[model samples]
Target: MPDTRSGDRQMAPPRPRPKRSDAEDNRARIIDIARTAFAAAPDATLQSIAKAAGVGQGTMYRHFPSREALLLAVYRTDVEALVEVAPSLLDAHEPLDALRLWFGRLAAYGRIKHGASQAMEAATRADLKSQYYPPVVAALDQLLTACKDAGHLRPGADADEVLLLVSFLWRAESGPDWQERTDRMLGIVVDGLRTAPRA
Candidate 1:
């Protein structure tokens, strides 16, 4: 055995280090900035986003190799936030009210998706829809079921149909009055789901 132990140790791969807290904070700040930038303009540049985030181009590229990567990351973050808020909202409010509030957040996310989707490749968009649709629908279903169980919503109210009804959030043209219009439209949809007036 001619230094067999040393050779075995050299052949072992080094373990990867977990990301530092500072690095994670920087990444989160970049995503937040990029989300706002992309919602304002679909073609916002990566350099501009990095500058706005107070990070160097090197740091930006280290976290996200390209514009598409950053966009995807931002979308992923938004989706996760949307899903995670449903339970808390339900706990804090009546089911119908919770559903309405969750939909408000969903509408905001729709605005971001509308702006960002234009810059994404068709395949990437399709992939994102496939990956994210289930969890979103599941969250909606949870809220809808809560409302139904409480007799606040009609038994026949379907989550998929409700989602379809609100699809206009992303499809509608953006203008000064867009928020008012969407809010009114969402109210109509929520009202339609009600079974009867609460005593």
Candidate 2:
């Protein structure tokens, strides 16, 4: 009688550790290097970027399977940072001041993203926008709501409209001293938002 017992079943392997901090650090470094390399030239090679990042080509490939993957990673990282800052900003500063500071950071992020935009294909751009838009819009909406309730902004001041209005700054033409122009633009926006009449 060659009867097999229930113990004969093959057990699944145990899972790996929850977080790969080393992998995460490597991925972040790779993204940072890729952002610089791609910004200089969208067609920048993965070999050069990996070398610049002090990683093997295989490691870069593991973190980002494609050129588009690396580019999108950089953009998404920027968006997530901007979105994540909202709550902390609102907590640390006065409502109006928080909004101003958040938008100022957004202006800076926009400069980085503008350079990244050259690397994206149409489909990738659309996908990236879809993934990030709602969260960012919600963040801005929440900040606007807080500002209104705190008497920082007018009752009827609009978040989406404000998003559109300030988007021009995101696409602003880069020049030798574009940061000056960007700062001036943000100041004008903050002043306008502060002055809108309450209902």
Best by lDDT: 1
TM values, all candidates: 0.88, 0.84
Candidate 1 per-residue lDDT over residues 138-166, each given as its tens digit: 99999999999998999998878888889
Best prediction by TM-score: 1
Alpha carbon lDDT at 160, candidate 2: 78
Please list the residue runs of candidate 1 whose C-alpha ends up more than 4 Å from where it truly belongs after superposition: 1-16, 122-126, 197-199
For candidate 2, lDDT tens digit of each residue in 1-199?
Answer: 7546778866779988776788888999998888777666767777889999999989989988888778777888889998999999999998888898889888877777776666676317366677888889988988998998887777777877988889976588778888788878778777778756334
Give lDDT for model 1.
0.89
